[model samples]
Target: MVENRRRSEEPLHCLVTGASGYIGGRLVPELLAAGHRVRCMARSPGKLRDHPWAGDVDTVRGDVQDAESVAAALRGIDVAYYLVHSGSGAGFEAADRRAAEIFAAQADACGVQRIVYLGGLTPRGIPESSISPHLRSRAEVGHVFLDGPVPATVLRAAVVIGSGSASFEMLRYLTERLPVMVTPSWVHTRTQPIGVRDVLRYLVGSATMTDEVDRAFDIGGPEVLTYREMMCRYAAVAGLPRRLIVPVPVLTPRLSSHWVGLVTPVPAALARPLTESLRYEVVCSEHDIATYVPDLPGRPLPFDEALSLALRRVREAQVATRWSSASAPGAPSDPLPTDPDWAGGSLYQDERLSPVDASGEALWRVVEGIGGENGWYSFPLAWAVRGWLDRFVGGVGLRRGRRDTERLRVGDSLDFWRVEEIEPGRLLRLRAEMRLPGLAWLEMWVETDPQGGTRYRQRALFHPRGLLGHVYWWLVLPFHALVFGGMTRNITLAAVKGAPARVNEARAVRIRGDRRTRRTSQR
Candidate 1:
């Protein structure tokens, strides 16, 4: 550990944009633990409210797209961490450029002493035009910050191997799911992957440097290996059987992306850029960062150790943040759902209410622990098939399981949905993020019945977009009877101990005055 010295200077005030994102979320607590005052900026501040360290720092509700908000967030900040990125592969470079320019200008105008940006690494000696769009955007953004008035330190890194990170997850799913693979030629291209711990250490160390930093530093793990080797090594470390990778020269990036999308939770849009970048070597070409932050607690961890640490987090469900935490670029804003009639669409729903002899607390406990390793209460094989289908079609799938087993709060990702709202022991509403023809929500509520027992209610709502939406609903209605019906029945069985619970009825619900329009079906 670095010695914590009593500094004569005042404690630095830091601002972290994308504080809800993977790296940013993890970095906030690190800065706080180091005794520096931190301000977290997020577009949706509600998402950050229930974080474990929420109350420990100040939060500014704002987006980098808005100049005024960026300016406000930058005010009174000594050091700023720009950790935001556009993961959408199409036309994201332009958006990233605009945001970076605005942030740089705001930081400069606000007199921020130092600005640090995390960017992707492009190998030395390659022309700028030859770089992948993703890496190109990152390099350009770094330049924007460096060219601005403030002294900027840009740290370029390759794939960060961490649990919940997109790259790590892609590697994980590919290795674990496929026994033999026809891989692309890029798999043999060398890359210097770094662990998240080292990346965070370098970031925190940057804050304490006495000398001014105005240039870019390339950072990576000590070992350099090809993508194919990394995958085999990962499988070896995880104790999986050896995976056979048959390399092919004809598979294009689009084809590789589709293959990856089908096998992994990653979408084709996000996977394409990453696939393209793998064609070139990404090993670090310089060691300038060591001069600034010398003798880091552990300069660099071994590849096996880094891979194991990430896997351990996955197995333990202790992932701090995910790459998908931030909203995608150009995605329409999802406002808090209001009344059903006001929603402006042909809305359809599947509702189930069951009366149990158990207390509200017991029923709520079962609902809260529905997804992940708990196995969806019932029809686990069906659930797994659905998740695989979603992944096949480039949807999020169920790979992003529950963050916690028993406790949940708003903004938590449960399987393929996000917790839109939660009331302890009373209600849980999850907004769907999976690929769908319409918007969807799964809500569970616990209430006390007049007879002094608990009533468990489950609702799945969908607001269709067009004719295809209606068709999709009808097509899946038959399966819902099996999947959703079994789900309600099983949840009741799990909740009610010793005392038998009775299924009340299934109803078709539309949001609005509850009693107005309801069609009940008795089992």
Candidate 2:
């Protein structure tokens, strides 16, 4: 057994998988701050480049399913954090089991000192079969690690309350959007929610656990509250009118998830598992983690305090990572086809060019702040209708919004589209995530015309999958003038009409608001 004192005295080398994901992305910096050398492994390493701590840690392109890559990533690592999970879906359990086995095998082969994993908190007396598939799979993964040759520390948590997290987003939208909600019976179920800060702290501290202490630990916030209580508290924290929640037993997990999909940014696919997990009570059974990583003052923040912190981050747009940080599975990764005569089937494009009476900087500002509360500058009804239709069909609606109102990174999600690429003041390209027959992309460019004026260029590209895809594109072709055309004309007009001043004013207000918040917290 490794001595805890010896392990704590030396800085350990850590390997963090799923570095592009929500928890993993935030964990890298925390580990680095604790004097550990970190290496990050992701399927797309480029996705992690935009993070502020990207340069501080080494990154490698690797997937857990690939044994060779996993082995290579685990090489020379004292501790490995298994943060990757096949989010709820078909065959996710088998995939998760296989991935865990491969990870454990590699970690053992590499002589890793400890394996740290974050998993869902299961109800104490509930049978395994009664648990949701998401939680069941997580438990199986934890078992794989604990029963392996290497020592493991599995931290089980209920819903994580943080700005931009899926669970918190669901809670925020439901409570804020619907003043009166007919909620599922699960809303009455009790849960011990944890803050993201505490989760990260426990994850980092788990690295030096004694070898004999290979087991799962229940970690959660200081208070245990029902889902209904959480929603009420969330509304209070957000300074909104108290929500009236009516619990109805008729709404099963499936029906509730679909309802949540329609109302929140989280789509049905992701919401289903979350809603299902809420069916069981998940209060923490013990606080054994404090025995090893002693809690400091105000440690494991109170539920209301966590909610306040999350709300503050959302209001200030200081969110470090979002649930949308990870790319949706099967999202198109192909670069925009530049060749007109390419052999990869038909490519359709609607191009719009307009001369702006404003500087290029002004035009770029309007483009960057196009979505979220600043509604897309176009036929408002058309965009809203389209977003609703997408949501109805189990797609990510425009409600997902943008991570930051005034800025965008490469992997940021903008409405139903993901930022594929962005060049500071020149270009911004978005790839569609809404369900469609084929692939689609929207590109906006700010350039200087030959006449020394600002040129705003917009293009909508579609790559059809089959005959249906081609037909689908043509069917929507007639509305291009009103949809795409209006976007172009209105965007340019907004840019010319005091866009620079508006942007600066908004920035100033945000800065002032942040200062006030800091002073209040201090007082």
Candidate 1 on 228-295: residue-level lDDT in tens? Answer: 99999987986667889999999998898988888766767778989988888888988789987665
Candidate 2 lDDT by residue in tens digits, 1-523: 4455548888899999987766787788788889999999999898877676778999998999999999999999999999988987779999999999999998888888899999989998888877899899999999999999898999999888765466776886677667789999998899999988899889999998877888999999999899899989987876667778899999988999999988765768888999988888998989999998999899889988887776553333221122122232110111111111221124578999999999898889999888887787878899899999999999998889888867899999999999877888998888888988767878899999988989999988875543456679989999999999999998999998976458668878999999999999999
In terms of lDDT, the poorest run of 10 residues in model 1 is 331-340
Q: List the pairs of residues colliding in candidate 1.
A: none
Q: RMSD to the native, candidate 1?
A: 13.7
The lDDT per prediction is 0.76, 0.82
Regions more than 4 Å wrong, model 1: 1-9, 314-523
Off by more than 4 A, model 2: 1-5, 316-523
Error of 1 at 511 (Å): 54
Full-model lDDT, candidate 2: 0.82
TM-score of 2: 0.66
